[model samples]
Target: MPGRLQHKAALITGAGSGIGLESSLLFASEGANVLLIDVNVQAAEKVQKLIAERYPNVKSAAIKADVSKESDIKAAVDKAVELFGRLDVMFNNAGIMHPEDDNALNTEERIWDLTMNINLKGVWWGCKYAILAMRNNPTDASKGLHTGGSIINTASFVAIMGAATPQLAYTASKGAVLAMTRELAMVHAREGIRLNSICPGPLKTPLLMDFLNTTEKRERRMVHLPMGRFGEAIEIAQGALFLASDESSYITGTDFAVDGGLSSCYVTATGEPTLPPPSSLA
Candidate 1:
């Protein structure tokens, strides 16, 4: 196996499938020990089996964690450190959008709370424990190593650009993710613990599918995408691999949008009106 992240240990939430799973497998393939965490214990165990079968001698484990709970977050991190000797990367990727997914004004209070608690606060707890665990690895800057580690939080293209289809709580939570990434980056930057985020566009994952199983909502959501298509979990995972590995050594407090350019594209700014760059004379 390659040493892109050799000897590094990672804990990824929501690693059952999608970006988290892709990243977990990729990281293992590239020579990093991986810890797959999820609320779905079966899913996590399955992923662990897959890694062991494929990588032969790769170091990896899976833990069941809600992510929204502090104790669960702590346990997951502890498991990684105990099994792999240290924590080098943390992917705060577990999330949920409200089932009702209404607009801001009309959104139900319960739904709002649930979405924010899981999507935003869940990420907060992950970062908190991961950073602390990472610091314990002892600085090894002399080796150009990520001894202080990195954190990649999952956000959305909605964090950068709002859409016509309103999932207000989801959008707001991602926006908060972007902010937290920057703040956390600054906080531990001197400690060499970098924090960044991935803002995906429309993804073809169980997470998104579960929300868009309704035909009406799915079509409405697709229409907003200029690509007229959905993005694959593998693509998002590749983006995460970059952020999680030494390749993004100097990159922090940034949001990588893997949304088929949805956030950067514009329809009306150039005025022909279908999806182009937003322009200004300034």
Candidate 2:
């Protein structure tokens, strides 16, 4: 049998590492033609090569792009369309969280601006170009091309809940992403395009590990996880896979929380579920 995304085409930003790289591999494995966009050219190329070797039947490419630049994002999307004949999924996953991004009072102006630029503005650009491209896609099934596509933005658990360890700029940017995703999803709901955001909790990615280099720091962050551990990148990628495929056709304008139930926690880290003693039934 064919894969879930048998004939789809997807463009993934930040495709060089972590969640992005994992998703790129997963999407290709599921039979989607993928375009891997990243600032790290060599890293993207490496993954692209891996895809070529592992999934020779899958069409894929690695393109260098700094998501902070609108021109670069636009060009990358355009190139994907030119190469694949249509755009079926857009995964805007590039973002940053700096160790210096403390509370509002301590966060540097440069850091604040940089975080918003790449995280917030970058998502907007990706959505903008994707909407434009998908709107007039020559391959629309109605016009003999593919059906409407899915757009996934990488927000965070911080977007919905407050963090005492305040990476203020990161939180703010993600909050903005959630807001943008909702409005866009509603606006384009009737146009065959689906827009959604994935809010992830702390994950075992280099970005998070590097920020929490010390065991003390890592432990502090882990204490709040409902799963009692950091999530893996592939776990989050699997969520994206569902949204990108037709399985989630009716889902849009929503935030898919893939944080291992961390966002649902109230007081303590999650543990085994409690069950009533069986003697009462007798």
| Cα shift from native, residue 57, model 1 (Å) | 1.8
Off by over 4 Å in 1: 139-146, 268-282
The sequence of per-residue lDDT tens digits that candidate 2 reaches over residues 1-282 is 688888788999999999998999999998999999999989999989988988899899999999999999999999998999889899999999998988979999999999999999999999999998888666645433455689999999989997757689999999999999999999999998999999888888899888888888887777787656677788788889999998999999999998777777765644653432122100
- Compared with the true structure, the alpha-carbon lDDT of candidate 1 equals 0.83
TM-score of each: 0.90, 0.92
- The whole-model C-alpha lDDT of candidate 2 against the native structure comes to 0.88
Per-residue alpha-carbon lDDT of candidate 1 for residues 1-282, written as tens digits (9 for 90 to 100)? 356877678899999877787888888887889989888889888888988988877798888889889999998899988898889899999988766877978889888889898899999999999989888885556645556888999999988988667789899999999999999999899987999999888887777888787788787766666666677777787788888788898998888888876776664122232534222111
The CA lDDT of each predicted structure is 0.83, 0.88
Per candidate, the number of residue pairs that clash is: 3, 4
Which regions of candidate 2 deviate over 4 angstroms? 139-147, 269-282
Residue 167 lDDT, candidate 1, scale 0-100: 87
